[model samples]
Every structure is written in C-alpha cells, then in structure tokens.
Target: MPQQVQGVIARSKGAPVELVTVNVPDAGPGEAVVRILACGVCHTDLHYREGGIGDDYPYLLGHEAAGIVEQVGDDVRDLAPGDYVILNWRAVCGTCRACRRGRPWYCFNTFNATQKMTLEDGTELSPALGIGAFMDKTLVAAGQCTKVDERARPAAAGLLGCGVMAGLGAAINTGNVGRGDSVAVIGCGGVGSAAIAGARLAGASKIIAVDVDERKLAVARELGATDAINAREGDPVAQIQALTGGFGADVVIDAVGRPETWLQAFYGRDLAGTVVLVGVPTPEMTLELPLLDVFGRGGSLKSSWYGDCLPDRDFPMLIDLYLQGRLPLDAFVTEEIGIGDIEAAFDKMHAGDVLRSVVILDGPDSDSGSTNPLEAHEGEQVSA
Candidate 1:
C-alpha cells in the first residue's frame, strides 16, 4: 500500500513551499523505503524553492538526510529493516563506464527510485537530487542507502549526505590534501568550513581560511584553520602568500565558486599547487584568465563534483571518525529545528547567522500546523 506522508514541496517556480500530502509508494525492484530521522536544510534546497536548479516543478525538497531502512523490495539483500543509513544522490550503477573503471565516484549513471512518489492528487513530484527527504519517509534505490554506525546523531551524520561530504572529499579525494601539507580554503560556509575540517583531518600542518564574514572565520579557526584572512580587508591572494612564506599554500580550495574567488585561489597557491573548486556557481558565471596564466600555473585545476565522493567508501569512515572525536561533524550543525521552520532556516542560512539548521523529525506523523512555510518571502523575488 502507498503510504500517505506529510512532505514539503515547491509547487511551482519561485512559489512558497507547501507541506502537502505526499503518497510514498512501497519499495519496488531494487528500491527501499526509509523512515527519515533527521534532515539538514541546505542552500540547494533553498535553490529548489527559488527555481535555481531546474524547471522541475513541485520539487520534493531536502536531500541531506539520515534515516532507517524501514522496508526493502524482495530483491534487495545488502539492506534490511532497521539499518541506519545516510541517503546519497550518487547511487552508482555498477555497469557504467566509470564504475567499470573502478572509479565509481565518477559513475556517469547515478540513479534514484524507478517508481515515483506523488502528490495526493496523483501529480508526480521530482525529488531533489533524486533523494527528496524532507518528510516522514522517502523511497530510494537500494544503492543510494549507505549504512553507518548508529551511534552518530542523525542531525550530524545526515550532513555527510551532501555538503559536508562535498567539502571533505574536495580535499581528501580531489585536491589530494596530504599530511603536513599547507592548505587554504575560501568561503568558510558549510562546504568551505567542512573543507577546513577535512584539511585538519588529513593531518595538514597549516590550514588557512578565507572569507568575507568575520564570524565565519572564527568558526573556521575552530574547525582547524591556523590562520584566517578577511577577503574584504585586503588582497586575499597577497595575504595568503604572506602567511605561507611568500610561496602561498600547497593546496588552495575555492568554495565560493565565483570567478573572482577562483582567481584568488588560482594565484594564492605555490607554483604547481592544486586548486580545487568545490563551490557551486550560477550557470551564467564564466571565467577568462590569460591562456598563458593557465599554461604557466603548472599544476592541476579541478572541479569537485559532490566532492568526488564514493559514498560506500567514505560515509562509514567519516561517521567512524565523527564517533571517535577526530572529526567535528557536530560543529557544522548550528541548530536543530522543526520541519515547519524551513523558510526561517533558509533566511538564517543566507544571512550567515548559522552553519546549518536541521529538521529533527521525531515521529512519522509530526506536524506543527505549517502548510505554507514561505510567509516571510511572499511576493519577493529571491535574489540569486
């Protein structure tokens, strides 16, 4: 039987998000149904609400989430009911060319549930990043569920589903940050901060944080940055160079994803040093550096997609590190909120007031009488 659950959705482009009756169908074939425990409100979710991601209307919001496998289809084997798991967007298809090459992280054919979740009126909904989780329960492909230690809190562990994983992987997997390396991260938001933490976890001797906001720089220091640069105060490139003995850092990551920040990262590193761009950018944004400069850099310039993470390989290891107190996953979660507070969470996120505002779903039928959560932004175009 299809389960009737209360889930959040953006009914149209730039319209307020609506909490409506979502019909979650039972798992079929290689799919499983998960009972959501907690989910973080991400900037990407705000993007969906504002129609920044796509024209896929009625997008089921929320993706960074932790849950339990409540049920699985007959063919499923690796997952069973009661397994604690984090939902990931990259459900790698084993037969894809990327997977066949033993680099499934670049799997060209990631996937979601074959069957659709729908509105109570029978309208089909597009799941955000193929893992719509701002609800009591969500259905996903079996491969999308990665089991981890249950000792980790849902609010913190769920974050590894997206931004946190992106940042950490940017350093460890893409940038190839190594022990005793000098590293710098630009942005200091959720993703950038996580990259700082990743640098620390990778045993970096020095981690430099760059951001326009002072408060975020403080948070970045707590996350393990040895130095913080206020990008607005002076030339960040020069500052980074001065701090790294005039040679710049060994690895510099651009978490802001803008051309300006990218250029700053490009010049704020040692010759042949790696620059990893983890920050997302608008489609219209473009970069045009001198072709000579690109050739003269003499190092790798990389774009980190989902931090180039392999969920099955990285998620459990990160959760273990979190449990052992070696990683500061909990610090990334600034607050725990009710599902109804999503719009306010978005505002807080945009205002740089919080690192993360996660929704803690205690029960399957949880409700706070919120039908429309966008009262604060009514009729106003969300500035990109």
Candidate 2:
C-alpha cells in the first residue's frame, strides 16, 4: 500500500511552501523508502521555491537529510531496512562512461526514485534534487542511500548529504588542498566555512577566510580559519596576497559564485596556484575576464559540482571523522527548527544569521501532529 505522509511542497513558483499530505509509493525496483530523521534547510531549497531551478511545480523540497531505511526494492542489494543513511542526490550509475573511466564522481547518469510522490489530488510532484526529504519519509534510488555511523547526530550527519560535502570536496578533492598549503576561501557561508574546515582537516598551515559579513567571518574562524578578511573593510585579494608572503595562497576557492568573487579567487592565488569555484551561480549570470589573464595564469581554474563527491566513498569516512572529533560537523547546525519554520529559516539564511537551521523531524520530547490523513479520501482532498 502507498504510504500517506506529511511533506513540504512548493505548489507554485515564488509561493511559500506548505506542509501537505503526500502519497509516497512503496519502494519499486532499485529504490528505498527512508524515514527522515532530520533535514537541513539549505539555500538551494529556497532557490527551488523561487523557481531558480526550473518550471517543475509542486516541488517536494528539502534535500540534505539523514534517515533510516524503512524498506528496499527487490533489486536493491547493499541496503536494507533499519540502516542509518544519508540521502545523496547523485547515485552514480556504475556503467556510465565516467564510472567506466574510474571517475565515478563525474558519472553522467545519476539515479532517482522511479515513482513520484504525489499531492493528495493525485497530481504528481517533483522531488527537489530527487531527494525531497522535508517530510516524515521519502523514497529515493537505493544507490542514493549511503550508510553511515548511527552514533552521529542526524542533524550533523545529514549535512554531508549536500553543502558540507560539496565544500569539503571542493577543497580536498577538486582544489587538492594539501598539508602546509596556504588556502583562502572567499565567502563565509555554510559552504565557505566548510571549505575552511576542509582546509584545516587537510592540514593547511594557513587558512584565510574572506567575507563581507563579520559574523560569518567569526564562524569561519571557529571552523579553523587562521585569518579572516572582511571584504567590506578592505580589498580581499590584496589582503590574501599580503598574508601569503606576497605570493598569494597555494589554493583559493570562490564560494560566492559570482564573477567578482571568481576574479578575486583568480588573482588571490600564486601564479601557479589552484582556484576552485564551488559557489553556485544563476543561469542568467555570465563571467567575463581578460583573455590575457586566463593564459597568463600558470595553474588550474576549476568548478566543483557537489564537491565532486562519491557518496559511498566519502560519507562514511566523514561520519567517522565527525565521531572521532576530528571534524566539527555539529558546529554547522546553528539551530534546530520544526518543519513549519522553513520560511523563517530562509529569512535567517538570507539575513546571514545562521549556518544551518535543521528541521528535527520528530522532536526528542514531543509528538507533533501528523500531516498524513488516515483515509484515502482525506489524503486526496488535502491541497498541496
């Protein structure tokens, strides 16, 4: 039988999301149904609600989530019921060309649940990034479920499902940040701070964090930034150059994803240093730089997608590190919120007030009212 559950849904573009009853199908071939424990409110979710992603209406929002597998499809082999897992958007198809070439991170074909979770009226809904986790439960491709240590806090561990993983991967995987290297991360948002943490985890001797907001810079400092530069106070490029002994940093990551920040990253590194662009930009955004600079730079300029992460390989390791106190994943969770607080959380995000406002699915002490209706007629009549 299809499960009726409460979920956050963006019924139309530029409208506020509502907690509605959704009909989630049982796991089909190669899929799994997960009982979401916690879901992080990310900027991307706001983007989807604002129609920044596409015309896909009735979007089931929220992606960064950690949960337990409740059921698995017949063809799913590696996962089973009761497994603690992080939901990942990219479930690399092993037979894809990228995987065949040993670059599973670049896998061209990713997987999502074949069936749609629908509005009670039987209207099909698009799951955000194929995870759609802002709910009591969600269904996803089996490969999207990466098992991690159960001891880790769900709020903290779930973050590795997206932004945190992207930042860490941008520094460690794409930028190839190494021990004793001088690293500069431009943008002190959740992603930027994670980059700084990644640099620290990778043993970078000098970690410089740049941002327009002083408060964010403070967070960056706590995350292992050796120096913080408020862009509003001075020229960040010049400051980074000065801090790196006039040679600039060994690696500079642009976490702001704008042309100005990209240029800052380009010039904020040594001649042969690497520049990694991990920030997301809108489709309408275009970047222009002097042709001479592109050729003049002797090193690489790269863009990181989902931090170039392979969930199966990186998630467990990160969870282990988090458990051992080697990585401060818990620091990223600035607050815990209820499902209905998503809009307010977005406000805090836009105001630069919090790193992450995680939705604790079932609060430790209380039983929030279930959004699901017991009867099919009740389910179908509730508008999303």
Evaluate all candidate structures by whole-model CA lDDT and list the values in order: 0.89, 0.89
lDDT of 2 by residue, 1-384 (tens): 899999998988889889999999999999999999999999899989999999889899999999999999998899999999999999999999999999999999998999989988999999999999999999999999999999998988999999999999999999999989999999888899899999999999999999876667767888999999878778989999999999999999999898889999999999989999999987888888888988888899999999999999999999999999999998888778889899998887876777788899955622323221111111111000
TM-scores, all candidates, are: 0.94, 0.94
Distance (Å) between predicted and true CA of 107, model 2? 0.8
Summarize candidate 1's per-residue lDDT along 1-384 as a digit string, tens digits: 889998999988877788888999999999999999999999999889888998888899999999999999999999999999999999999999999999999999998999999997799999999999999999999999999999998989999999999999999999999989999999988899899999999999999999877777777888899999987789999999999999989999999889999999999989999999998899999989899988897899999999999999999999999999999888887777887888888877877777777898865424323322222222321111
Candidate 2 achieves a global lDDT of: 0.89
TM-score of model 2 vs. true structure: 0.94
- Which whole-number lDDT from 0 to 100 does residue 216 have in model 2? 72
Instruction: List candidate 2 stretches off by more than 4 Å.
Output: 363-384
